[model samples]
Target: MKYWLGLDCGGTFIKAGLYDLQGNELGIARRNLAIIAPQPGWAERDMPALWQTAAAVIREVLELFGIKATAVQGVGISAQGKGLFLLDRQGQPLGNAMLSSDQRALALVQAWQKAGIPQALYEQTRQTLWTGHPVSLLRWVKQHQPERYRQIGSVLMAHDYLRYCLTGELACEETNISESNLYQMARGRYEPALAQLLGIGEIVAALPPIVGSAEVAGRVNSSAAAATGLLAGTPVVGGLFDVVSTALCAGLQDETRLNAVMGTWSVTSGISQTIETGFDHPFVYGRHAEAGQYIVHEASPTSAANLEWFCQQWGMHDYRQLNQWVAALPKAGSQLLFAPFLYGSNAGLGLCASFYGMQAFHQREHLVQAIFEGVVFCHMTHLKRMLQRFPHTRALRVTGGPAKSAPWMQMLADVSGLPLELPQVEETGCLGAAMAAMVGTGAFPDFTAAQQALAPRLESVQPDAQAQAAYQHKYQRYQALIGALQTLQSGHSKEAL
Candidate 1:
């Protein structure tokens, strides 16, 4: 049986999987990734360490399945988006990779907003300015670490760097690079004008050549082959952003479908035939892994991580126990509202997580329920925005850590008033990457064929009309709470000034 390898490099873990052409996972391995926070707002990972972890997992998975290196047909990667991975002229990492959650460039983002740089760039890229974007991080390096910035020769995303490490090639994948503010949504390439506006024009030379997700980037070189136990000259396909990969794995084929990811980030996305930049709020517009479609998305760090935080702080390790407690609580009319901004806020970078309307009568169950509801509300915020463009969206395919919970999936369906579909596969990101590899290696004619052959069976969760009504009222309160918080934050900023 011909198999493909898929590597998923996420913020907290590097996962590798071996899959057959029929989408059956033969084996899987994962390694915990460590993040370095040298400063309060900085989040980074040792570049070499990341590659080592990825390589180790790849080797481990192959050994687990007892598959010879030559038996694997191809390899592909799916990784977290918007992180900065810089390489020198000789393809050496300039420094630790800046993660998507890093806020070291927050001040630079604020300065850009104050100077109207974001507004001007949005007109071209249709992407919101964020501290973690390559352009922002590049500019931050230029100003703060001038010498290091000067040494940079290539700027790649997380998966791009991994692919480079494997294939001895340097190229940015489309879905990932399109999320960088450097890529122009309308023009379909890196925009020099946008770089100049962000004051990082000089570093534009560092941008790698762009490749489609299913295209062959390069073959595994001998060094990479020796390290990972993969055949030398095995085709390594251009990979995908985790968002697009997971969406594809969940069977999102066209504009009619939406995908909600409740992982480290609360992400809602749908494919669009044309770019829609008219939204008053920030939404990411990027090229889909499949050509001729745009992945319209809105995301913020407000999801299952909120529950993880609550569980950790309260020393609650058993999720089943937490779910039982949450399920026992009243479904409606809870006075507590948790703004799931523990990492960062959708409203702005300055706002932090908080619980509003907390009363003395609130119990642990109430807080837990509030956390669940807050996460659903956060997904609603993005799904609602995406629905504006995809008015015909009939169903949402949800994938992430939260999808494992039936109660949480029901909450999402109830809150969004849309049927939720969960893929039977656990590692949808890895499966998606494998699909790309299959396509790149000519195992399938195209993505449609691979998807048709490998798409996982899905279980559907329908919204409860009665519960939707209750969430409708509570969602209004959630909006009001957000507005009130924003107003309070604005006032505090003025006071500080």
Candidate 2:
């Protein structure tokens, strides 16, 4: 029997899944990845360590299922987007990989906003500037670590680096590179003009050739085959950014349906045939995993991670128990609002996760509920912004950690006043990666055919009218609170100066 291997490289874990051509899961394995925060607002991962973990997990899944190395037909990767992974001329890492959540380049982003660099780049790339983007991180390195920047020979995203380790090929996948701020959205390639505007044109030569997500990048080299128990010369496809992979796996084929990722990021996005630009707020227009499509999104680090943090701090190790506690709580009357910005904010870099109206009478349950409400509110904030462009959005395909919680899904439905559907596959990113492999290996004609054969079984949830009304009132309060906070923050900044 033929099989494919899908590897999803995430912020805190590397997951590997073995799947057949029909998308039936044969086996899966995962390894925890450690992020090093040597200083405040920094997230770094050991470059070699990441590749090792990925290789180990792939070997584990293959061994567990007792699958022959020759039986695996193809491989694909889905990884966190926007993180900068640099390699020197000899194909050695220059330093640690900077993650998507790293905020060390906050000052650079702020300076660019002050200097109008963001507006200039936005006109060219249609992507909002962020601290973790390759442009921002590259500029940071150029300024702060000139020696390392000068020696850089290639610029790669997280997945690109992993693919390089496996296939020894230097190429950038389109979906991830589209989010790098270096790519010209309209022209579909790295824009030297944009890089010049960002003052990093000197490194444009460092950018690798772009390849479509499903295109065969290279074959598994002998070393990689030995390390991962895969046959040498097995094809490795150009993979995708985790966002696009997950969205595709959730069956986001058209523009009418939105996909909400409630994991480390509260990401709300939809596929679009046309690129929409010049929004009042920041929204990303990235190339979708599927060719000839765009994935427009409003994303922020405001989702299940908040709940994870709370549980970890409080020693609530069991997720089932935590869900039971949250499920038993009364609905919609907590007067408290959570900002859900533990990682960062869409509002601005200065704003953080907060509770607006905590009272002495409120207990831990109220706080827990506030976290839940806060996360949904954050999703609503992005969804409302998206609705301005995609008013035809009929329903949402919800995925990630929160989809495992029934009460959380219900709250999301009530808060957003939209129907939500959960995909049967728990690891959408891995499944999407496998789809890429299938297409690359000729198991299917294209992504569309592969998707049709592996269509997910879904469970639907609809809005509750009374709960929606309550949330509507609370949403107004949430908006007012945000405005007040922004004003107060602006005032403090002025006062400090």
Best by lDDT: 2
Which TM-score value belongs to model 2?
Answer: 0.97
Model 2 weakest lDDT span, ten residues long = 275-284
Q: Using TM-score as the measure, which candidate wins? A: 2
> Model 1, 185-257: lDDT tens per residue?
8779998988887788887888889999999999999999999999999999998899888878888888788
Provide the overall lDDT of each model, using Cα atoms, as 2-decimal numbers.
0.87, 0.88
| TM-score, one value per model | 0.96, 0.97
Residues 1-497 of candidate 2: C-alpha lDDT, one tens digit per residue: 98999999987789999898779998889999998999988999999999999999999999998999989999999998997999998899999999989999987898899898877777778888889899899999999999999999999999999999999999999998988899998899988988898889998999999999999999999999989999999999999899988888888888789999989888988898887656687578899876788999888887888888888798877877667867887677889888888888877777777898988998888888888888888788888988888889899899998899888999999888889889889688788898999998889888878888998999999989888888888888888887887888888878967
Cα TM-score of candidate 1: 0.96
Candidate 2, residue 82: the lDDT equals 91
Q: List the residue pairs that clash in candidate 1.
A: none
